[model samples]
Target: MNQIDTGLVKRLIGEQFPEWAHLEVKPVKFSGHDNRTFHLGDKMSVRLPSDAAYAPQVEKENKWLPILSKELSLPISTPIAKGNPSEAYPWPWSINKWIEGETVTKQNVRDLSKFAAHLGSFLVELQSIDASKGPIAGAHNFYRGGLISVYDEEARDAIENNKDVFDETVLKHLWDLALQSTWRRKPVWIHGDVAPGNLLVKDGKLCAVIDFGILGVGDPACDAAMSWTFFDKSSRKIFKEVLQIDEETWNRARGWVLWKALITYDANKISNKIVAEESYRVIQVIVNDYGR
Candidate 1:
C-alpha cells in the first residue's frame, strides 16, 4: 500500500476545502492502521481511508456520529466536512472536530479500576440509546459486534499453526467455550474497536472515545473484550459489575479477546515487535483469566 503523506494531504485540502487550505497539515504521531489521520489545524482533523475497504467508514462516521453524539455523555468525533475523490486522493475522506486528549495507556492511567468504571459508564450510556434503525454487524465492520463464531475457523487455523508458540490445548478450550453459546439479547450500539488507541484520556481519566468507523449495533459482548485487552482482574471485575454483564456474555467477551490476540500474535510476531508483544500480553491475560 502506498503511504499517504503530508504533501498529498495539502493538495487535497487546497483543492477541496480551500477555506482551510492555509492551515498547516501535519501527520499525527500515532496514526491508525485503517486510516491516515492528520491535524488539519488546531481544532480539526483530516482522516483519509488507507484503502477501499476502509473507505466506507467515512460515510458511516459522518452520518451516524451526529446521531450518536447527542444521546451519549462522552464526546465523539463529529465530521465537519466530507471530501470527494480526486486524482490525488482516490477515496473519500473526512474533516472531523479534533478531540483533545492523549491516547489511554497503562502508564498514563492513575487508577485502573476507576478508569474501568468510567469506561463502563460510557458504554452503558451508549448502549441505552435506541438502536431500532442502526446498522447490523456485517463485513462493513469486519464482523465486529456480531457473532464471535464468524472468526472461528480463522482462530482455529492460527492455533493449529502456532502450536509451537503457545499453549494450543488451552487456546482450543477457550475457543470452544466461546462457541458454547451466542448472544440472545437484542443488539445494542457498540464501538466495535475499543482499544487503547481509540480511547482518549486526560488527567488520568477517560475523556472521549474516537474512531467510530466500525460503530454499529450488535451483541454487547464484543465491547466487553476490553476486559482482557486492557484491564486487569481487579479492574475487569469493576467494569463487569458496573455494566451488569452476565456470565454468558462475560465468557463470550473472553472469546472475542482470545480470537483477536491469537490472530494478532500470529500475524505480527515476526514483523511488528510492538504489536506482537502487546498481542502476546493480551493472550496471557486471557489464559490467566480462563484459569481463575
Candidate 2:
C-alpha cells in the first residue's frame, strides 16, 4: 500500500485513460481502510485496493456489483472502468461511478427509527436477490457470510486477554450463544462490511451502500451485526422486525458483532481511546440486550 495521494492517481489516470487525464483527483473525505478512493472529476471515482489482502475485491466488485445494483433499489458501488496494473501502481484497480451522499451517523440522520427500518428493508432486498452464482464465503471477503466460528480462537484470545477490562463471564456466554446454530435456509447475499462508513445518506435519508470489499453469499447474520454496533433499542427493534430473522440466527448475529468488537477493543484500547470506548460500548450493548 503505497501513499495513495493525488499525484499517483493522476499518473495512473494519465497513463491508462488519457481522456480523463486532466480531471482533478482529490481524496474523498471518508476514504475507507480497505481501498484508497479519489474523486475522478464529478461523475466518477477511482478506487484502488490499499493492500494485497484487499486487492482481490476490485475484480469481485466489478463482476457482481452491476447484477446486485439491478436487483436492489439503493445505489451500491458501480464500476465504470477496470484499470490495469501499470508501473505507477502494482495491482488492478477500478474507476467507479461516484454515488452522492455522506456516510451515515446518528447526528446526521433525521429520524433514527425510520433510517433503521429503511436500511433493514434495503438489506432484505439485497438478500432476496439471486445468489446461485455468487461467491461463497471465503478468504476473499474475509469469511463474513460464513460461520462466525472462523475467528473463534482469535475472539476467545481477545476476550481472555482483556478479562480485566471486560466481564469475562458475560463475554464467554455471548460467544457460546453465537455458535448455537447454522444458517438452515438457503444462502443469501450479504454486504460484509455494513458499517456507518459504508452506508450513505442524503438530506438525512439512507440512500446508498458502498465498499463491498467483504460482499459474499451465505449466512445473513453477519449483516445483522449493525443491530447492536450502530442502533439503539427502539431503532434496533424496527430494523429487527424488517429482517425477520429467527432467534438462532439472531444469536449468531450477536456473535458477529461481539467478535469484531472484542478484537477491535483488544487492538485499540491502549492507543486509541475513542474507538476503544465505542467498541467497549458495543460489547456492553450486546450484553445488556441479551440479559433482558
**Which prediction has the highest lDDT against the true structure?**
2
Candidate 2, residues 1-292, lDDT tens digits: the string is: 4578899999999999999998999999998989999999999999998888998998999999998999888899999999998777889999999999989998899999999899999999999998899999999999998988899999999999999988999999889989978997889999998899999999999989999988999999989888998899999999899999888989999998999999999999999999999999999999898888
Q: What local lDDT does model 1 show for residue 102?
A: 95
Q: Which stretches of candidate 2 lie over 4 Å from their true place?
A: none
Worst 10 residues of 1 by lDDT: 1-10
Cα RMSD for predicted model 1: 1.3
| lDDT of each residue in 1-292, candidate 1, tens digit only | 3369989899989999899999999999789999999998899999999989999999999989999999989899999999999888789999999999999999999899999999999999999999889889998998888888989999999999889988999999888988898778788999998889999999999999999898888888888878988888899999999999988888788888888888998899899989989889988888888788
Clashing pairs in 1: none
lDDT of each: 0.90, 0.92
